[model samples]
Target chain A: MVTETSLSPIATFHSARRGRYEVAHQGVLALGEGTIVVEPGHNFEQGLQGLKGFDRLWLVYLFHLNQTEDAPPVMVKPPRFEHKVGVFATRSPHRPNPIGITPARLLHVAGRMLTVAQADLLDQTPIVDIKPYLPFCDAFPEAAVGWGGLAPTPYRLLWSEGARERVAEIASAHDLRLDHYAEVQLQLDPTDTSRKRIRATEQGFALDFREWSLHYEVRGEAQEVWIEQVTERPEFPGPSSLK
Target chain B: MVTETSLSPIATFHSARRGRYEVAHQGVLALGEGTIVVEPGHNFEQGLQGLKGFDRLWLVYLFHLNQTEDAPPVMVKPPRFEHKVGVFATRSPHRPNPIGITPARLLHVAGRMLTVAQADLLDQTPIVDIKPYLPFCDAFPEAAVGWGGLAPTPYRLLWSEGARERVAEIASAHDLRLDHYAEVQLQLDPTDTSRKRIRATEQGFALDFREWSLHYEVRGEAQEVWIEQVTERPEFPGPSSLK
Candidate 1:
């Protein structure tokens, strides 16, 4: 009995996670930090008075990057799932209403700006609402996760000295988060070549980036993915190399 | 920099709690059942697949009853708090976006219809989205609840035989839910006469409900409110009497 509703952004999120590939699917796995700056001229400062006391907050934000003009697909392939699940069953950005809710660990609240960690939002994302996370009402530790529980457990990421140095150099030179991207893609189902640009190498596995490649070995027993080396493709010269 | 965004409803919620006074502030305390009937012709049936496995779900719905056309007030007085806190600090329905998210216990899902319990939504409320509640991503048991933690504990309600019979008679005759309304209002702070239309009687406390009155006595030490009687106002003639 209700018509379409209109909403306006109250704040902007500033984060280093620039692209979808750089951010994790789950906010809890997103290691990056972000700041939410509430717009001035409103009484938002007064509204934010008691929010600092809470250790965590629920941020309701818009999925600004969803460019689909038609109705969202009925089914979606979650990166963690091998099969296509219903769009309602998965936390896909493409939905009837392009809205997202993530619980971020509240780090600091200074006036109209709030800093939060483990946020999966992209840079300049619009935030619509912020509510303190009440454990008594929000937390349901015993609830069954259903199909989500069947997803493969995340593999602990490890970097060798050589790989770490190479990744750092590439990150500083190109402002690309290769290491973060690798973790986001490889942490779960590191050997799923069907979903990721991965292939079997003589040593172990090699995941291909734009112009660079990451060589990693999966220690299945220990649940770890060790990155042994990082190298640029011989045929493709990158911007950093040309510079 | 994004402009105003528009959203359409994907489903309609049917619940017995019709009015604002009948619904609890927290969905976990609503103690009522509701069904979400997803709209047809949108392939919503396929979108509902695999959702039945989840024991709980997060429902994102619009606050349709919010009639204010202007920007929402920055500060709102929570029923549990004496002082007005930031609107974002509490789960107030009056918000800039007017969107609400509540975690509900999933009971059943058949085709495009899903049954849930403890939903704090009004009848025929428009639902925007539904996502499975993943405990790992949602649960924060130790998160400090800030001002919410300081709210007084709920008082268990006890009804006498006579009061129960009277309430049942009124409920069947007038289709009124007096028992549910009492629980929604009295469970938190029954003695607070400022917010509720309550007055002190010679025997105990009386809560006004239209032409009907509920007489109850608060046992502070036991944290219980005992309903002694349910009576119609002497001046107000009831439809049951006329029948």
Candidate 2:
């Protein structure tokens, strides 16, 4: 009789730079085009003996970024949807086991380092295992994607040199997305309650960051937010209490 | 920084009986239709929160049958093929990590008990985690299946009353599939050199399976084996030295 056993990750992934999106984009990129390096990997040597023939591999890894008991409540609010959805239904990061699996295109496998066409992992995602994708067994093209079609509306992000520097500085402190932080936020709710920066203008709307203000025209018909200008927010005096 | 961590299976699968096949059949049954009971399953309560919306789920379970590190030699001889294939190529039980992920049809989620339409796990198999099958993102119908099209030749398996009882008794000890074990062995090489069971016969071949002698005729052109009778092997006198 087979008994219970424990498992430890055999390897960890290292990448050149971290991306803005935490999870892999469904419709666009199944796996990102990033070359990841794994180390002290036992699966490298004998485990991948016959993997050279296949062009794709299944990356079985742990969600190391979400390895914690402190998760949001069961009903998680997906970014695209209006109401909160159940945890199991939506592919939310806050899971009980925090295990993540993705299919990556195999570019090259040199020793321990596996260069893949795409990867949806953090800089140092712990890989539990890797298996060659048996296509005949795992193909289901006609399968339905439940609650998975809501793509966030496209919003062009514009930044001034000064605005870029300020956004990067503020984002670094909180370790937030440099590319998508402002862009995604504005697309969802351009009224800009975040940091209390949005203002109604004659043209459209203006969102004021620390020292920068982003001017954008909301095209309701097209469902697009076109950022026109990024200007510096003027300095104001202290509160009236000081007077 | 997210460091290395360990993981233990939360739930264990309990079934009324174990089946013949180890890995999920590709062209045949992707996963067996059975209602499994998972208990005190760490992720049961929270993990299955929104599973009712979808009809299918991806069961990330451990290959509990292959828990021991003391596995057979790396060059595993697959049943269908004559030559030895790499351990990584075939979906054999003897794997480096022994983690099997299968897509199962969710029947009903009553509290903790998730009745699934399909499951390939053995009885008392340890479940590592579960993930919902996001079809849109994971669809790849045109993917090639490398070294995946070897079908076992069809053979007729017949058993007498005594042979049936003996085969069941032996299979019970090892907790294996009696029908599959017999059918697969015969399909691959009816000469029965697999378990060292083949003996020369005037008609065709005689397979000595423990105390049972399975008499069969191999039609080479038809690629079929027809078993005539199953009889108990005669006990000979001890060697001269032992006497």
Candidate 3:
């Protein structure tokens, strides 16, 4: 066997809060409840300035909450897969190393902080690394979808009695705009092909677009819809939200 | 805080020679070895049948040999770095997962057994998974090389007394050519930029290749290199391997 060598970390990351991370690579990722700020213009600009020109960025973060002693699975039943596929074939949170990567829109960057748009990650997720999205290298214009074929048809959200009110309340409290096409687009099925129907208690309403059962809990008064859970079936067990 | 989900093993890897591996989705990865079969084929073909066309397929195996129960370092000093770079910057085996990917040309496959070209792995390393390399996706026509910068310069090996004779012996025994460019290219850095220097020893020759010190022992009158110890160097106590 060829003898191997070790390595060391160049930077460190500290979680300040949900959606916010502080990376000790000369600057910090000040993620506020809604807006993110990076202090010290120099460091912030150095890390995020070039990102502004890109339409999207790849966020490589640690699944800090998924740490466990159990061995990682080679196959996973994704929330949408409903336990039908192997873990390696699906993008499930459960993996050997919970290294989460998401392609998110680059809204803006101020100093060391970057304000991202359309991010599905929870607040305060530790951001390990970031790279600009190159359309040529990152985007496969004519790529074939594996098992989860073409994108599913768009669906409308039907909120129940108290659902709309709750959405509005949550939006007001968070000081975020709820009624936007971007937000609606986020609800569309980026994966899956066939359409179905599903319902859940946590989420006020369920709509099946393709193979996924999308659960939405709308704070009615707030005019906002929060995705409570996404599963293959309405009867699937809800994920435990520790916080 | 989101509720923590129960950690569970998602998959289990089994091998006759290497220890079994229980992998969970999003779990840490350990290195081991496995065999790969290469079928003759062209890049234009699709599916398993095309895979049989190539005499050798590249194996991107993991370097699970040096894994330990320690937090990974953020930086590492690579042997090519002359022991000065950080771990994250180098491809050192000492990392959080100690995952090493190498491309080994496939030789032949009989049933499930594969005879591959020279590989740097031990006898039985667990093979994680395999995928047919698509030249369109994997190859970069104009990729830039940092630090070491592209392929190394070529060099001719000048074996000491009995070294060439030993090469002949191994060739005849293995029914292969052992004294050609393949062996030399595999043994020495083509660029000859490696700081390692081989010196004649009582047994054969000794060379310090950063993480491991190597010694060559004669194989039936033919000089063959046998691995000695894979230990750390005090003179250049570089960073830990994992990060």
Alpha carbon lDDT of residue A139, candidate 2? 49
Per-model C-alpha RMSD:
3.7, 7.1, 13.9
What is the DockQ score, from 0 to 1, of model 1? 0.70
lDDT of 2 by residue, A1-243 (tens): 333455566566665335434434432243335554444534345555565667667777777656667544556766555666556666666665577777777777666567776566666777766766765555455544455433344444555566566557756775544334355356455654443456888888886544556677776666567676656556733233111
Docking class of 1: medium
Q: Score each candidate by Cα lDDT.
A: 0.86, 0.59, 0.38
Best by lDDT: 1
Interface RMSD of 3: 11.7
- Of candidate 2 chain A, the 10-residue stretch with the lowest lDDT total is A23-32
Worst window of 10 by summed lDDT in candidate 1 chain B: B234-243
Local accuracy of candidate 3 as per-residue lDDT tens digits, A99-192: 4445555666554566665454554465544544433333333433344423333333454445455446644775432222213333344222
Could you tell me the lDDT of residue B92 within candidate 3? Answer: 45
Q: Give the per-residue Cα lDDT of candidate 3 at B222.
A: 30
| Higher-scoring candidate on TM-score, 1 or 3 | 1
Candidate 1 lDDT over A93-192, as tens digits, reads 8887899999999999898899999888999899988888988889988888877644346788999999999999988998988888898888888987
Better of 1 and 2 by DockQ: 1
TM-score of each: 0.92, 0.69, 0.40
Ranking by lDDT: 1, 2, 3
Task: Write model 3 residue lDDT over B157-207, tens digit each, in one string.
Answer: 345455556545654664333333223322333223243344555765454
